[model samples]
Target: MARVPQARRQFAAKDRQQARLCAEQRPRAPPKTALGVWGKAAPTPAARRVQDARAHAANCNRSTVVLKRRGFPMMAPGQVDLLKKRGKKLGEGHFSTAVVTRWHGADAVLKAPRQKPNVGQFVKECGLLHTLEGAGGAPEPLGLCLYPLAQVISFAGPQTLAGYLEESRSSAELLRLAADLCGKVSEVHEKGIIHNDLKFDNVIVDGRGQIHLIDFGNANPQGQTFCLVSKGQRCPWLGPEVFSQHLSSPAQDAFSVGFMLDTISKLMP
Candidate 1:
């Protein structure tokens, strides 16, 4: 890991400290599940099987859960076949490809890691989702399997935040959206995960204007620093130190939210 410059590193630390405070200050909403709120579930064995499997939570996690690949229960090939036959195709990203399909007759999306190594990420995502499970405003994590290395999530709308902005002309609505976005990010930060990459393309906008954050491959735990792997050029949502200091934290996430607010400003007027 390349060491970030000390000046930028220090600033990131400060940013994270403030972000933590903001997260602590906000009132976190409880997850809404049929069983009850998160951490308070009395799910049947069958119900538990249908949702969380090992390291993957149907929604979010408080700590990183890493599991060995072998002997791990995986989704049957038949399950994968069903998704392909029943679901529609969604967009693909660098790490994985998604297929929207029917699960128990409900519309669903199956996310499979494109590479073997990325399987760990999908597993991590499950834990994150589990951590956030039953939480209001987050998408439902239907099921996850390891044999075929796949996860089944409820099929959210296909529209991107970028596309949603095209139809919005009201500054009031835009500001509300920005606040909602910040609120969601704050909730995630409180759980100690930094999305690392936050931008228009990474956010999903439902027809009702709800925003869902997607993609966690670049996500990192709060306060911990890693060698900047994407290396060199930084995305527009990234703060200045991302490239210069080579670190990721709640501060970077905070900066991304600011950058998004700036985007909203330019786009509105």
Candidate 2:
């Protein structure tokens, strides 16, 4: 073959070498996992924190805000006064009525439902409240009075979460509040009890951001029992798994916690 220019031969060799190297290289791609994207095999503390923050934000957005006020008769002027009522009717729904009250030199919330007295419910709620009270962040169960004709427990409180959100509290504060509430509730549920009527109004937050869960008309012992509330009286939140023509279980209470938290996030100011 005719002699080729040295520069041209060198150029050909260089091109061949470049092609071989390119063939040996791995394909470029976007990361397929969190760790991959973050350049670690596992989540770093900072990454975990970001994820937790986002999850918390999502939880707040999904927190339960629908205050069920049904069936709860209006507070008699005397009962309202007796309760040291403070805030205007925070809300009302089909099963219960909520009033902001001041008791024990602190802001409080009192909830009374129109339904007949449920002693099992009462015990469960009181027990849980008492237990949570021990945690300090939970609302203290000051006392419960059974309304003679109304068959309602005039529950005096720790406080209402709604009022706190209404005041436009911060997410950090809210999350901390939620964590405390979750801890208390987890303890309650662990005891094999179900707060069947778990809802937004039932969770009260006070000026100090303490959480108090209320409304126990539907709470039951850990074991199964016949559904007592009239079919029409059922709170929509009582999931089918728990309230399908019957009373709820611990899972139902857990569902309520999830549902309640979901409601809070949406209502968080």
Candidate 3:
């Protein structure tokens, strides 16, 4: 090589110094973790499946506009005052409260979240109920409310199965109710929806003794994983595998039905 000029040598050294500084300042790739790469834990297979299922539900099923066109209009905030005037508190739960009220001159149950932050659970329940519309053993979804965030559904009954069980009933009647409950659960499963929280509290029995399954907050599409974040209280009816694997299937609901039947059997005289 020919002798380098002093000016060129200085320029080359400065370039090298700048390159080293740039390399030092550049962020190194985050170390990979067992869960994922870039220091962000990757969502597990179960989580991904759950996310996909939720996304599908939100995109395809949770459309208030579609429901409105289908005859399920949303209740406005102004109507909430009327609801309060005519409605009677039915029950209260961790996330939502139910009230018996009149909607459009029909008996209806208005369920709203305990707080605005819990509106997501109400929306999920509304979407699932809409999907189960026309199916037997489920309450008819009337519409959804916006301001306070509530879902208007046909009143299932005056009492829940839990309260109904308190009344005297012959063994034959209990057995029949058990069968009816199982049939209703089967109907839901047929619709490809899993009522993850299946219990006496969620079952409404009309004066005619007809059973209706309510509360789809915990419901998920078949094959999706159970939502760990929003999991409710410890349920005796849940299968062991559900907690261990976080997977949801019709089998989990089956286990709950079985548990309910077993409990009813014990009540029989």
Q: By TM-score, who's the top model here? A: 3
**TM-score, prediction 3:** 0.71
Q: Which stretches of candidate 3 lie over 4 Å from their true place?
A: 1-71, 228-233
Q: After the best TM-score superposition of candidate 2, give how far the Cα of residue 236 lies from its true spot, in angstroms.
A: 4.9
Question: lDDT by residue for model 1 over 103-168, one digit each (tens)?
Answer: 786777788777664556777676666666523244566766665667887666788888888774
Off by over 4 Å in 2: 1-159, 226-236, 245-248, 266-269
Better of 1 and 3 by lDDT: 3
Q: What's model 1's overall lDDT?
A: 0.71
TM-score comparison, 2 vs 3, better candidate: 3
> Best to worst by lDDT, what's the order?
3, 1, 2
Task: Please give the CA lDDT of all the candidate structures.
Answer: 0.71, 0.57, 0.79
Report the number of clashing residue pairs per model. 19, 25, 1
lDDT of 3 by residue, 120-189 (tens): 5666677777788746478777777755567788886778898999989999889888888888888898
- Candidate 1, which segments miss by more than 4 Å at Cα? 1-74, 134-136, 240-248
